[model samples]
Target: MDPSGLPDFHGLPDSPVPSGAHDSPSLSALDRRIAGCRACPRLVDWREEVARTKRAAFADWTYWGRPVPGFGPPDARLLIIGLAPAAHGGNRTGRMFTGDRSGDVLYEALYDVGLASQPTSTHSGDGLELHGVRITSPVHCAPPANKPTPAERDTCRPWLIQELRLLRPTVRAALVLGAFGWQAALPAFAEAGWTVPRPRPAFAHGTRVTLPATDGGDDLHLFGCFHVSQRNTFTGKLTPAMLREVLRTAAEAAGAPTRK
Candidate 1:
């Protein structure tokens, strides 16, 4: 149990595996490992606390309280990057952006743009799937206060790097959901020798950047938008129409035939 009086996923040694283990695995194999991760003790403790408290209204819901993994078609060209897992949202549901207020606006916009098969994200078992998109987070684990330190973000980069390597699907564009996701991808881009321009690029509702590939090929495009956190959505920092337009632009750049 944790300070919040909730059960921690780390308590069980045989639960899920942490990222970067020598599993000789595919995306699904990585998914299983991430489902039982206990690497970050701090995150594990905080997530358990959120689960235990139940928050009154969510008392009956089963808490996932574990690491969250990216989910979508293996060949997806559009990669959607989110900030981090939410306490009651991704941490409780064991799936990114599910079972929380953040997902409400995200899924709705996804459906409106014809990227999602459904308009709601209830739980991991809700059979949600993205037709041409894949969703991942900067930090796979739920951070205390939903803010991951720079070190924590660095620690989590290997997993994202591996995922991108394995899912090399001629990426159309990336939808960075917040400042953290944008910052997290920077190191990866630098490692790949992609030249990013100055002014560092700011995080806004619809900012875009193009990076040259290492192979001297076409540049990869990145789009920035506010995270789908409850605070942003409820406060009107992002709107459904704005999100839909971003998706449309990404989809157009991603090319139509790649959807298959």
Candidate 2:
């Protein structure tokens, strides 16, 4: 295990040279490369800095610090994309959508819909499992103020594209959480061989776009949802029922069964 005592799969503590994620032949390889990525200087600095100076609540915990990787099965049918990791969330737990309020809402919804084995994802080893869903983000590293610059988003696009390519055979639908993820994902889907529309549909809660595969493979149903951030959830902008409705619809679109 690394100095943090978490699994060694999260990659080295210090950022290495740029990881050529495009060359990854499998999802596992892509995840390792993503975790070791140091492509963006600003993100690299911010994530490491946050790791060193942890929040008061988690002062006794060892932070993951390095880039967080996607979590779930390689053959996931439903892919959920979000913005970058939360500095004290994924950046601390070493797994996407874990250890944060956003994750609390997301995992609970997934569990309610029978997509997840548990309703809570407190850490990497919490035994939570996604049935046929995979969670990832455009930016692997946490950024300052929970926002990654456009350039950083562009720089991280290749990893998402490669991941899409690897999951192309199985991923039939995607749930993009927020405008940032929606914008970032559209281009990556096109690059990964899915035929996105020319004008690119505008982002809106409950928006659905069907992207036909260039190779005549299965079509992808993309759904947009408000982010599960505290701002939305606390303010009732994204209620539990609303999130579950979107998740259930998207999961069904992917041909994955829902409990209700």
Candidate 3:
């Protein structure tokens, strides 16, 4: 294991395994390892810095200050991939996409599709549950200015790669939230033994791709949706109705049986 306590995948070629990928059967155990990661010095420094110097609105709140982990059931069939945690969002709330405008938009959409137990994700233990979806990111920690260098992203690839390996059996499809997330996920899918398309699919507002199974398992479907960031939402680039339709499609594709 390296300084991040992760088995270094840096030595591998043609593989984008998350540095933290390992043989842990329980996602909870994997999450614990993710929380302890300090693989990227720049991100490690930046996330902790924001935690200590919190915004005025959350001045009294204690921040998680560690790598945020994927949230939802272990046997989830639908996976939602997004960019890294927000400095004051998941970095503060210890849950993916929690305590932020992004969650406000995402959870609301998930609820519309009957995938979320609640319409709001305020904190880690808020009693919110995702019916058949699991949420994760390519970068586990909050990056500086919300931008992770290519090297940082590669180093963190193993965590998500391993997550895919564990969930492949049940995960029928994945919803990639943005171009960054789309890029991050496709490579990891290839690394996790899925047969990616010859010419990689281009990303768009509603792009869809099908990845065949190499291990004789079920094929995996991929969908694209504009990120639910404030920049997009506040500007009307991605509205509630738009997001709801995408989530409804993704959930149903994953066999969630969501009602229209």
Tens-place lDDT digits, model 2, residues 1-260:
33234536733444454443436878887777778778788888888999999998888889988888899999999999999999999999898988899999999999999999999988887788899999999989999999899999988888888889889999999999999999999999998888999799989999999999999899999999999999999999999999999999999999886899
Extract clashing residue pairs from model 2.
Answer: none
Q: Candidate 3: where is the Cα deviation over 4 Å?
A: 1-21
Query: Candidate 3 residues 1-260, lDDT tens each?
Result: 11112222232222223345256676776776777787787888899999899888888777878888899899999999999999989998888998899989999888888899889988776778889899999999999888999898888888888889889878999999999999888889998878899788989988888899888889898999999999999999999999989888888888975757
- The worst-scoring run of ten residues by lDDT in candidate 3 lies at 1-10
Task: Report clash pairs, candidate 3.
Answer: 17-158, 18-157, 18-158, 18-159, 19-158
Most lDDT-accurate candidate: 2
**Mind giving the per-residue lDDT tens digits that candidate 1 earns over 1-260?**
22222223353343433445453257776666566666666777887888778577677776777678887877777888898888878877777887677888888888877888789988766667787788888688888887888877877776777676555546657788888798898776555445677767777778888876776755768788888777777787877777778877876676522222
User: Model 3's lDDT to the true fold?
Assistant: 0.84
Top-down lDDT ranking = 2, 3, 1
**Model 1 misplaced regions, further than 4 Å:** 1-24, 192-199, 216-218, 256-260
lDDT of 2 at 201: 90
Q: Best by TM-score, which number?
A: 2
Q: What ranges in model 2 sit over 4 Å off?
A: 1-5, 10-21
